[model samples]
Structure formats: C-alpha cells, structure tokens
Target: MNALFKALSHPVRRSIIDMLRKGPMASGDIAAAFDMSWPTITGHLNALKEAGLVSPERDGASIRYRLEISAVEEALAFLLQMTGAGRKDPGDEP
Candidate 1:
C-alpha cells in the first residue's frame, strides 16, 4: 500500500493513470505527453508497476500498459480510513 501511495504521489504518475483510463497506451505515447525524457517516464511506470497500479503487456515490439483500477480503489479506501469514517473497508460505507 505504501508503494501505491508513493506511486500516486506524483502528478505525472497521476496524469499517466488518468490518460490510461481512456484506454491502454504505448509507453512512447505516454512519454510523449510529458516534457521529460522517455527514461524518466519509464521510471514513473516502474513505480506504478511496483504498486500494482499498472501492468504492461507486450505486443510485438511495443509494450502497452493497462491501468489496474483496483489500485485506485485501494487508495480511496485509504482515504476513507483517514477520514475517520470508522469503516474498516471501503465497501462498508453506510
């Protein structure tokens, strides 16, 4: 969970996930959206991967990344906890 929060803490990473919500994208396409170099974007992708926030599948020579929505849900669950709702789980909403 710590890894997930850390991965999402960055604006670029959040933006990447937001863009991916539209659909899966090639790493190059995602990298192109930022002014940073490809390697920097890749580092963000790696962090997201470590948190299970994103998963990449190989298609021929290109790698397409898909967002794991459940990770976002987990983050929301954490927020709910921080809000002092006293709910142990996100699904326990009254």
Candidate 2:
C-alpha cells in the first residue's frame, strides 16, 4: 500500500517499528533510543500511525506504541502479488 511504503521510506521509522515489534513501548522510551528530539520522534511515530503500521495508546503521562504486523503482512502480500504470487490457479485461467 502507498501508506505502508511511505511509512517505511524512512530508516528511522523502520528502526522504530523494529523496536516496537518486541512489544509496545512508551513514546519516551522509543524516542530515547534515538539521538533525535522527542518531537521529531513523535512526528515519525505519527507518520507510522497514519500508515496503520503502528498503534498508540496513552498510559499515564506517556503514549505507548505497538507495531501492527498485519499491515506489514499486507505490504508483503502486495509485493508478492507484484511477483505473480497472487495469480489464480492454472485451471481457473480465463
């Protein structure tokens, strides 16, 4: 999907998703892993959320982010389709 590709276009966002894949993480914790400002990290997270690649929740004073693996799978499926993996069976050919 366009959104998934857009979200993954940045290396930072990919790394952020990798971090979250282990489990949900607080916004601060995710930001701390990088040498960037909190607001900058927040923006990246927002992009990921917009792409449906991640989900966020408010916990106390921090927002926790989690990876949406299904979105990643959808992207992968799109890629596979491009490679002809999604074609119908030979018996079903027109």
Candidate 3:
C-alpha cells in the first residue's frame, strides 16, 4: 500500500478525498475548490486514482470522481492491525 500512503501524503489529495466523502464530484468542481491550476489538481486526482482511493466515471463530457470506500477500509484495517486494536489482553486488571 505504498501507493495509498504516498497519495495520502499530500494535503491536496487529502482534501480531495474529504470532498469526495460527500458524494461523487466532477473534476471541474473539485478543481474549482482549490487555488492551484487545473493541471496541478488533475495530478493529485491522478495519484488518488492510481492508489485506488478514487474512481472516475464518465458523465457525458465531464468526469466524476467517486470514493472507493473498500480501499479506504483496507488502509484502516492495516492501521488498526498495526495498533493492536480489538485484541483482548488477559494481563489487565478486571
């Protein structure tokens, strides 16, 4: 999941993911939310797509990006496993 982590390393990509959490959004709409140029926003979207965090759907002439929750879950599962979550410890006081 190096690609997933790498894509998430950027603040812009994180913001894009956050925006997509609401629902699928057009590329133009996503780009409008950022101060950077369209090309820069596109690069971030490409990273997210490469990481499987987002999927692009063709909506007529525009492309809408939707979040892939399963991929996100995969990442969360990894983090939870590394953190030892949901594991009962018998060495604790009752």
Candidate 4:
C-alpha cells in the first residue's frame, strides 16, 4: 500500500492515471501529453506499474497502458474503512 501512495505522490503520475481512465493509451501518446523528456515520463509509468495501478501490454511496436481498477478500489476501500464512511449502524445489530 505504501508503494501505491508513493506512486500517487507525484502530480505527473496522477495525471497519467487520469489519462488512462479513458482507456489504454500508447506510451508515446502518454509522453506527448507532457513536456518532460521521454525518460522522465517512463520513470513515472514504471512507478505506477510497480504500484499495480497500471498494466502495460505490448501493442505491436509500442506499449499500451491500462488502468487497473482493482488497485484503485483497494485504496478506496482502505480510506473508507479508516473514515468509517460505510460502517453498519450499531443500533441495527441483531
């Protein structure tokens, strides 16, 4: 989980995740969205991949990244548990 948070710590990485929300995208297209050098964007993608927030599949000559919804759901579930947002009502207990 620490890795997930660490990967999300960077704005660039968050943006990349947001981009993937629409659908899988080529690595080159992702890099085109940012002004930084290719290596920098690649590093961010690697971090996201390490965190299990994204998956990369070879698409012919390029790689396409897809968002891993399960990882995001896990993070959201953790936050919900911490905040008691979805807890069952004690008064309703049998």
Q: Using lDDT as the measure, which candidate wins?
A: 4
Per-model CA lDDT versus the true structure: 0.92, 0.93, 0.96, 0.97
Candidate 3 runs further than 4 Å off: 90-94
Tens-digit lDDT string for candidate 3 (1-94): 9999999999999999999999999999999998999999999999999999999999999999999999999999999989999666999766
TM-score of 1: 0.86
TM-score per prediction, in order, is: 0.86, 0.88, 0.92, 0.96
Model 3 Cα shift for residue 84 (angstroms): 0.5
Ranking according to lDDT, highest score first? 4, 3, 2, 1
Global fold similarity of model 2 (TM-score): 0.88
Model 1: colliding residue pairs: none
RMSD of each: 3.9, 2.6, 2.3, 1.2
Model 2 clashing residue pairs (backbone): none
Candidate that beats the other on TM-score, 1 or 4, i.e. the better one: 4
lDDT of 2 at 40: 95
Please provide, for model 2 over 14-50, each residue's C-alpha lDDT reduced to its tens digit, 9 standing for 90 to 100: 9999998799999989988999987899899999999
Q: In candidate 4, which residue pairs get closer than 3 Å at backbone N, Cα or C atoms, i.e. clash? A: none
> Residue 30: error of model 1 in Å?
0.4
Mark the regions of model 4 whose C-alpha exceeds 4 Å error after superposition: none
Off by over 4 Å in 2: 86-94
